[model samples]
Target: MSVNSQITRTRIMECASKEFMEYGYQSANMRRIAQAANVTTGAMYNHFSNKAVLFDALVQAPAEEMLDRFRGIHAQFKADLPKLTFVHMKETAYLGTDWMLEYIYAHFEAFRLIFCRSEGTRWVSYLEELIAVEERAYCDAFGKRGRRVEDMFLHIIAASGFQYLVECVSHDLSYEKAVAVLDSAKRFSMAGWQELFKL
Candidate 1:
């Protein structure tokens, strides 16, 4: 793309971000976004096929990155499951929480859109997707250890664990405050997991 074209695309994305943040995906106006970007509707369409595409462009990368990071954390834990102890699990959980907090803060706007302003988009299911990933990880880990856990129970645990993380994002907690809250939550959750898993 030419410099001017690239600049216009960036401008459209910025304006679209503000529009989505303000009105949410269901109510955001494409024409208004175009106007805000100082581009014609046709030009905006040329850059982004539609409102959903535009919204995805803004958040897809960060969303995928977060999930990938979570998967990586679980993958590492699973790899070392044979030797993993309660203390190691607790320490890893804390480290993961800290990494997640730092990532969310760095991409606060993208996450805010996902958590708060993405009702009409597929991003609305992002939390559920995260929970599913957690659920799968737990199932795999327990199965590998020949430990049987009920699916419903695993779902509840996974949902609650991720919901605690989402609370930090939804409430817009400061980094320090979020860290403190998640630390306490992690301690509680690790104790529960340890008891349940007999680790």
Candidate 2:
């Protein structure tokens, strides 16, 4: 794309972000986004084949990067599992929550869109997918230790743990407030896990 085309594309994405934020993905209008960006609908289409594609363009990178980072954390935790104690787990959880909060704030709008305005997009399932990733990691770690946790129990733990994290973003909590909330949540959860697993 030329300089002008790139500028137009960026403008379209900016306008589209506002539209999606206000009306959500299902009700967001492409023509209105085009008008806001000072482009014809045809010009917008030249840059984005459809609304889904445009939404994907805006959110895909940040969403995938968040998941990849989360996976990396779990991978490292599992690698250290043989010698990991409850203290290690607690420290890791706090450190991970700190990193995750900073990252979420850095990409606040992208996550806001995913959590609040993705009703009709494939991104709507993002929270469920995140929970599934957590659940799988727990299962793998427990299995490797010759321990067994009920699948339903694991799912509940994973889902509720992540929902707490999601609440921080969805409610637009301040960084300090979010950190405080997550710290309390991590302590609660770690206590529960320690009792259940005898870690």
Candidate 3:
């Protein structure tokens, strides 16, 4: 990539991240981000077509990459441990939630912008993808069923139980307390799936 493109992208991410954190997504401004980067609005436009595109590139891209990283690790380490083994569970938990918290800490404003400012509309489908990943892992540990699996997937997401737990641990609790929650969530999710499989 050209140096100018790289610089502009980095500058936009850094400044937009701060701005999005300070303001909700709706209030985020490309002009302000451009100004913060010491670039004119035209330069910002050359890099990103719009605020949505910039947000996706700078914020969503990193978050999605983290998820992919988690999934990759889980797939790799899964076979080394028995189903629900400590290694399996702890690594998975860390990859998914604990690390997610780290991402939030680093990009706290970006996440708040995506969820609160955008009303989480953009995250819904992505959340579904997360559920599918967990569900596949769950099914791998348990037996796959058609209707029941579907129902449980919808139930978990709809109840917002896991999401609520994530929010509670990530935001409402201390870091140590949040780690504890991650531990519990991993165990609980594993146990639940194991039971579903009659394993």
Residue 25's C-alpha lDDT in candidate 1? 93
Per-residue C-alpha lDDT of model 2 across residues 79-191, encoded as one tens digit per residue: 88888765776788788878888898889889989989999999999989888878987887788679988999999999998788789888989988988998899889888
Candidates ranked by lDDT = 2, 1, 3
* TM-score per model over all chains: 0.89, 0.92, 0.62
lDDT of 1 by residue, 1-199 (tens): 9999999999999999899988989999999999999999999999999999999999999999999988888888888877876576667768877888899889988998998999988999998988887788788778866889999999998898878767888788998888889888988988887787788
Off by over 4 Å in 2: 144-146
Tell me the RMSD of model 1 versus the true structure.
Answer: 1.9
Residue 72 C-alpha lDDT in model 3: 83
Kindly list the per-residue Cα lDDT of model 3 for residues 1-199, writing each as its tens digit.
8997897789878898777666756788788898899999998898889877776775576667767875785586456435465445545655666666666556555555554455333653655565666556655533322224565764563345347444743364655666677677666865765566454
Task: Give me the displacement of residue 22 in model 1, in angstroms.
Answer: 1.5
- Which has the better lDDT: candidate 2, or candidate 3? 2
- Badly placed stretches (over 4 Å) of model 3 are 1-9, 73-124, 144-150, 153-165, 168-177, 184-199
lDDT of each: 0.87, 0.89, 0.63
Name the best candidate (by lDDT). Answer: 2
Which residues of candidate 1, in runs, are more than 4 Å off? Answer: 144-146, 195-198
User: Model 3 scores what on Cα lDDT?
Assistant: 0.63
With candidate 3 superimposed using the best TM-score fit, by how many Å does residue 188's alpha carbon deviate from the native? Answer: 5.8
